[model samples]
Target: MTDPADGQAGSDGGHIDSFDDLDIAPRVRQAIADVGYESPSPIQAATIPPLMAGRDVVGLAQTGTGKTAAFAVPILSRIDPTARHPQALVLAPTRELALQVAEAFGRYSSHMPEVRVLPIYGGQSYGVQLAGLRRGAQVIVGTPGRVIDHLDKGTLDISQLDHLVLDEADEMLTMGFAEDVERILAETPDSKQVALFSATMPSAIRRLAQRYLHDPQEITVKAKTATAQNITQRYLQVSHQRKLDALTRFLEVETFDAMIVFVRTKSATEELAEKLRSRGFSAVAINGDMAQAQRERTINQLKNGQIDILVATDVAARGLDVDRISHVVNYDIPHDTESYVHRIGRTGRAGRSGNALLFVSPRERHLLRAIERATRSTLTEIGLPSVEDVNAQRVARFADSITENLGSDHLDTFRQLVENYARDKDVAMADIAAALALETRDGGFLMAPDPPEGERGERRERSPRRSSGGQFATYRIAVGRKHKVSPGAIVGAIANEGGLTRGDFGNISIRDDFSLVELPENLDNETLSSLRHTKIGRNPIDIKKDHGPPRTRGGAKRGGGHGRDGYGKRSDSWGKRSNPRVAGRGRG
Candidate 1:
């Protein structure tokens, strides 16, 4: 017999005419209509019914596939406005993502009066989070660390949790919060409905599902295989420090109707936009913190050509469909493969061909590979702009501006002044014009000289042979295989934490409970100490020479392989395990 939760009887292949057709409450239907969503996305269509029926679901969908609404709509429908306890817990990896999910819940819960949502993360004050908890939020969205902190302090009680969601399970694992996740789940009641969403099902994530979820109904929404075929993908493998310079150079040489530059943080959006504005570009920043009126005005300016460039974080840029956006710049490599696809999707809309440029630091090369594998598209390498190229573009733009201004009567006075200067200086008219041209150009007349041959800013070439003859020096990190550290995590940590450019490191090998990385041999002791203090996935580095068995700073055995759960096993002072909630069906 067909299960009632399946809701497949509509005969239109699960597509509902309205939220009413899905047996949802009137408030939910009104909220759905207010959001202007006429039909459910594929993932939404498949997942919502079972969710509304209170069945556990495991959804596999790429970012931007409308997964947020898939679970959100059903969960919001289940909210009892008077109860005021945490009935739904949505755990995300990053603070930014947690805020985004909270905002989403707010949007869909608009018609449901007295429904409150709170987002908790590490950077915020615990007192503020505790206050919100006291005020009785119906739904809680938080990062694992902060959520675990709250659970242990007796400030958060999830005994009433009817819904538990693990958003971006793979990302939580990649960030080394798996053990914390397990602990969070262990605190939840076993009967709670759990939803674990991820883009990829790696072994670790699969193990999480097996251990925590109970006969979950799996739903996978395949990512769009091709970027809008209309978009051309190009990337420049530059260090993070050089990205601004590279982007500036690219802007000088390339022309576009309007451009969207994607950055990782809200602060970066403002900072980059301000820098571009100071550099004479009509630019602005868009982020989630902006008021609705402000966001609309900024977007309108871009559409009307008043703003030529917009620096924005991903959450603010979502649902923005602008026909004038001709270029998309990944100012920061996206956090995951799906984000790459979404950032590029900002352009190339409405059958328009667009250009996408990705700036990749050496440490983010693994992200590049993941994106390539996910999208099945090749990204062509883009070279830095030459001085000649910048000069040529400047000259062309100057001439065009002059020709346009010549049609105005105001040029007559300037023309006479130029003629007077030419006659007084006994300079030929052409020479006088040339001098004026040179003076009018921006970026100055003299270009900076290229670096010397061995230091031309190209990545240092490394020999595969492990001998000291090469430019790299091999150093051992005290946490490795037994610690559950992967080579990619090592690379990401060093590149982001140690301030080492991707080109500053080479081959990496993972051994039992530690790893070794080949870095530039010229690294000073200060840099080495800084590296030793660096933390990857929240574990401090005991970076020392790779002699043999793992030892403490004082040379004694440092316990068994950083503990069984690897970096995720660290304990918190708040009376709870610091591990991320295990992928599971329980509520914490």
Candidate 2:
């Protein structure tokens, strides 16, 4: 049965301060809370209610303004999670982006739990793709080539699909994927509700939208700068593996009433929150997949000082307003300046002086620059907190706690108990107090010896294999043209997962079955382990050490980021973006 939540689409064109103002399902509302969004982005506020009313939307907005959720929320609220069979399909220009959109859908449907969102791209094995299709996923996000491939294989049936999204349509035509896109659209039922979102609508895209989208409401969002002048921005360059430890260390030394630590994925919010809770910190997780009731409770807890730390993702943290939020930490750097601006804006509200600390890996320095340019302010580079710093702060804070308790009447009860126990056991009063102090520090875990000085960035180690030229071993990834892979995608995944500089790469040889790439020869075990689990096009690289010199299959030279036209595209312009933090679901 079609969900009645879709019937709530009639509640359009109203000013809303919160997600609850929309006439959507309770669970969908709850999922919004889980996401922890500060509030609706401009585009979301303008387009969502009409879309909820089942109206076709023609949106002219830049990416990174939260456009994904604008359509995702209304669509998800209407879909029957149990009767899953490709009820919605979102098309992107490249395979890399198809996966990101699919991840977004998966996050949105987390509240439903049973709803399936599958990503199909060419580089992935047909067997694996077929398995997901057979399982009856409700939403399918894919690139033009792979979506056509699935259609030709009769592995995808869109007769049941009620919604279709052409995300970044101008880029699709620019990349010459127009024919493939049209084919997919033709296969869909004409009764489907279509949404065409493009940053710049060329005549080609406009024509495509004219034919496919039926009497759509024209929603245009003018690019507007959103900034918080009161925010003091700072960044720290820490390796991916050490980010969590670095964050905990800073929390120990920094002063704040409330804090929001932003991560990239939904699972990360929960994982980081759990880790913080284990360390005796008050924390909670907020993401797009949580129930409305649970999300409300979490917000209430934060408001009441029951939890001081909120671990969140971009979508979940939208429209969240809390006066006590004195600090915002970008645990994962945002890919777009709009998201970065919005992230740090969570604090420093209402003329308050609040500062945001961003964590940057060596490879993500470009993102740091992008934020600086967008905000028109230089971010001071800060060093990670040393073990000595953390321990000293802990000692001072513990001492203050003891001093506060000295005059408290509550100590009167424990005093007599300690005296009675010490007398019966013939133990010294100081010895009994020591036992209590041991328990006071939670089994002395917090008082453990700090990380070693070498690991504390105190000394540079001279390794036998460390290379200055970066002429390290060449590794191969099993994704190329057949997988609809782009060079930028390869660079993005490697630099991110390997925690190496994005520019550190040497020659890249992308083959039909695999690609050869040169990187620093002496990678640590942690990076190598991360590379093994990492997927280039959702396909594992099976990273072999390549004990011998680099060899190319068929002697194919490494390629640049070019589409079908063979124009050498810049890395920044790879997919609907000339820069990493510029392109996304919305504009700045």
Candidate 3:
């Protein structure tokens, strides 16, 4: 391999001027042209040349700076697709990201057609992944934990691995999977080409890179501006259950040419987009599952202003350079600072100011702080939208539409109909207009009352605390210490099942055969019924009263031998008890 310099400098300091300029295969250039990527990102520009030349690379780039293709193009170009052994291994911090990298490999290798890609993660069954490995997947993308599990089981064969990519290396370290990563890397061939990409190079990550990577080229991509300085960053500290409502309110009130809403999961992208469409917004979901053609159409719609909002996962929003996007709403706060930065970076582009709104549940406050520190930018606190704000925006939109369309030739018929209605109802024009305006508003005229002050805060506070006392009801679940069920699982299950606020539940104890959970005493029958049907792990709870038998009025069990601690025959237990009434009766 030749140490050739490509003129392309990607944002992350990689070179990608020309595929021919580097030592990559001719097929890679064809594939790159097919994908319509004329130039490489800085990370890609700098990393690809060194990687193709068999030199290890340490790249520092944020999530959306085209890092996957950087390593992927080089690895795929060098690997023998017919070998059918794992030649390239990419480790990601998350299952979703692992899957995303796998998909990118598949896309870039569409021309190759023989290169096989596999994604392994915790949620997937191990047996299936093992079978895939047996059949031969040339490239493997996996999380450290699952990959380690496979390695320990002897199901994964990395002995022939020629190239290794540690994507999000910093995140894996933070998640405490550093040891597993080290073990996995140890299994690779000694002559393997290693490339480590991270958003931030902490001391641990730097040390790991120094120990593992050979004389590697260092590349870094810094934000050109401080988190889109023109974009106003704000967050609504609402509970998860209330995020949809809050999002809807903001969509109605905020004016924008177009908006991109980032969600964490593919399911969330579709679900939220569906809800927004039902609420009469022109919205569509963009995810990895969508074909390139469909994704292009969606982006076209967004650019042409046909779709007012786009609900998308991080992967789908990559390489999006739409100038009309006036807002980027983090429907779900990203899992890491890198993802947060990428999500907000969609807006405030092309010298135009933009708006970024993040929806943060109280549990994710730590993430908020992390993002702030990483970006060196402050996120302003924004309260949930009031009914008045929604109403005012609705009215303003209605008035604008009327003003724009009232002079059109088509409005004569509607004008006549409105005049007829005014005459028939004996109402003035202003009253008629007011009635029409009220009817046109989406959430009906009356708004649900703002929840009591401090109620949401109290619920947030109760999220981590366990409940105690008979003041709360106890539920028995079959899974106990054996299933690794803990207080957190119990709490999460109940919260998800009952749709009850965290404050409504309390302490949980896991016994050998079952677990006891304390729920609020005033839980309505509907909530209790829902809880009973809610499944935790594979067991549905038998939600009932607590342990112990019935007690008498004197607070003594019916068949109890004695109330005293160890009085042999209940000797003088009641008679010797120091009580004013008993003493008086004895004297009499």
Candidate 4:
């Protein structure tokens, strides 16, 4: 096997069928097999060899995809067991994960008595950790917060580090520990091999990857069930009257790098592609009806970034492996559950999270339920972006376009021209800018003005604002986009059918199999009974009061979170030490 980085021969590369193929110490292999790891998972198989070869790797896969062993096995194989100073640092998001990872290291190197590992985290005794540090450990696994605390006091050392791992990067991004993670990485030697594993690559994490990781090989592993835990599955309940419009609204608000829209028929693929193109989207269609050459060109255009969206039937999209595609829209419900899974799998590839939206009509409820049961994960229902949402996004995009041209050579010419016109008309610069904003958007909103609730009759019930909190119950509705539900229709059905006012409701969240609604806290039995047998559009809703104990009166968690525990120090640690500067321009 050859290395992609420096063209060096790697004795263990490509597929490995057994633990022995990993080329690690015999004791390490024995311990792995003793734990009953019969075979390496896809991520472990692909990543272990590159990592073991000392190449930087970025692992892309969903949660629970066996990422721990992928990096751990390789580092353990390469580490000098006799060294007492820490040579590797594993950074995780939470204290629990830190401990779990340290335990795994212990289990993997069970026979190697000289190999020492330390688990550092908040809520642990500092004296204990300091003693372990003084005694010297070869591997250190810690959460980012606690790791920074040690770095501040000059107690922990990475001057001789060989490996650095950033595990659960997406979780850290969510917990707002990205800055800490970056700072900690900066303190490490540049020669150290870096490995990062993330369930999703939102732009922030992507930027961090670009800054920190050297040229790295990318690997992606699909979930064992062939469905991704990272892709958000949603179904939009649309009447035939509004399917096209609902889809258009979605395109307006979504942030995607590339998109694929699937339809049942070849002709629908072409038609939808043309319709989207007419709306100024860079869209083209590929179908069984297209010539092979034409199909190839369309796919290439999508792959090369010339086109942003592809409209294709399942047959035409076979063997497609484009990682840039970030969204998969089932513009038409699939004939079966397998087709549904295959279509969405195209987007959420290489460990990047993708969004999947389905357009289900009134009679497609059973198909939606079948998909949910097969995937073993419930989809979150989301409302169509309102007119305000579309308008806000459009204006923001126009502002970006103008800002991009700010450094152009001819910008002064245009800037002066606008200034002269403003002076002649005695108008405010702000007024001139607002007029330019309207003109840039083509003198109209990106979408037609959304109809008021009364204007659309029963289907026009406006969604209530999301509740701030305070005992509003989260009710579950069996009906969803599968039943052609619009938020307006949901709000209307509940208000008129259940004798509740608009104020009695809060924001609604829909899923493929069901929908969640916020209702006034502690409604009377009479009102709750009236909510039964409520019909929206063509389907009757099976509504019930939901009981979720984890949620508090107003929605936020009771303790905020365990992540922000102040200064993870033991009570008796060398009297009261000043809290180290946690986040700023530079690390102490």
Best by lDDT: 1
Tens digits of per-residue lDDT, candidate 4, 495-523, equal 43443433355556655556777776766
Q: Write the per-residue lDDT of candidate 3 for residues 316-416, one digit (tens) a residue.
A: 88778899999999987775565676777788888999999988877678778888887789999988889888878766777788898877998889789
Task: lDDT for model 3, please.
Answer: 0.72
The local distance difference test score of each candidate is: 0.73, 0.72, 0.72, 0.71
What does candidate 3 score on TM? 0.67
For candidate 1, lDDT tens digit of each residue in 1-588? 011111111111245545566766678778778767677666777888999898888888766667777788889887788998999999887666677788888878888869989998754556788889999999999877667667767899998788999998987777556767898898989989999999789999888888888898998875454577899999999875567889888998998999999986676788999989877788899987899999999888888888889898877887788999999999888755667777788899888999999998776687788878877898999898987788788778877987898899888899899889888988898988777776766546445765775775443444242211136666778776667665545654454334354345555656565666666676667657656755554566677655444566996664444432222333211100221121111111
* TM-score of each model, in listed order: 0.74, 0.60, 0.67, 0.40
lDDT of 4 at 169: 83
Q: Which portions of model 4 show Cα errors greater than 4 Å? A: 1-14, 226-588
**lDDT score for residue 456 of model 3:** 68
For candidate 1, the lDDT comes to 0.73
Which is superior by lDDT, 2 or 4? Answer: 2
TM-score of 1: 0.74
- As a whole number from 0 to 100, the lDDT of residue 377 in candidate 3 is 91
